[model samples]
Target: MTPTIPTRQPCPPGACICERERLVEIQGADLRILYLTRQEEKRLLDRLESLSSLSDLEHMQRRMFEQLGLRVTIVPSLNEVRSMRGIGINIDELPGLCRKTRQAIPAAIRRGLEKRPEIAYELLNANDLLRDA
Candidate 1:
């Protein structure tokens, strides 16, 4: 008996090569990870810290999903106890999350998130966010 080696199908025409590469890299992995450069992370953190309303967070979430295929949701903790589907992190927990990962989530932003837990979104890492099923 002969064992078969798995093969990846070729990407279709006009498909995003970068995205294809990312998918290939994560094949059979337990987690889908997105990596960001330090500058990118800083910019994202700055934007997150500046979000003034739920609408802003919603817009950012939509853009992230569209551009990076990352599903993120931000809502008031008082109205929703937990996310039924995707990963959920409390707004007040961003600092601790960052600490566990040894990422640079500024103290000012942590303070802000603590003060306004409603504006919280999951903070994964300085350069990447991981999603594991």
Candidate 2:
């Protein structure tokens, strides 16, 4: 089933495309891959960095997953996981993550997640992409 793309809010004439839609689409067959723009990424990283406890992170995680279908796992260190694996954010690297630009965070996330068929299936199913298949 083809996923329904969300409509973007109206922008002023002559506005840049980036200012119109904050979600960046990455091509894939099995999953609808979307990621935040640089500005949005920085905002998210800043918010994550400000969390004072694990509960706060968990709350944010749930909200993000439910709202945007983005999965983020908190890890003590980035070295504990493979770079090309899941979207695991090292709590220690929040500042660095915020500094990454030119869609670097989103690109890394797409690379890490695109390889996992199960994740694709799960996300697709959750979004009801499989309902009419």
Q: For this target, which candidate reaches the highest TM-score against the unseen true structure?
A: 1
Candidate 2: segments with Cα more than 4 A from true spot: 1-35, 75-133
lDDT for each of the candidates? 0.42, 0.43
lDDT by residue (1-133, candidate 1, tens digit) is: 9985333233354542334444546657422223333445567667766767546656866775564444554333333334321223333321112232223334334444655555444433211333331
RMSD of 1: 15.7
* Every model: Cα RMSD to truth: 15.7, 15.3
Candidate 2 lDDT over 1-133, as tens digits, reads 9996543334354533332233323333212223344456557656654554435546777876665455565432223323334333432211112223324544443443444445434444454545666
Q: Tell me the deviation in Å of residue 98 in model 2.
A: 13
Give candidate 1's whole-model lDDT. Answer: 0.42
TM-score for candidate 1: 0.39
Best by lDDT: 2
As a TM-score, model 2 comes out at 0.34
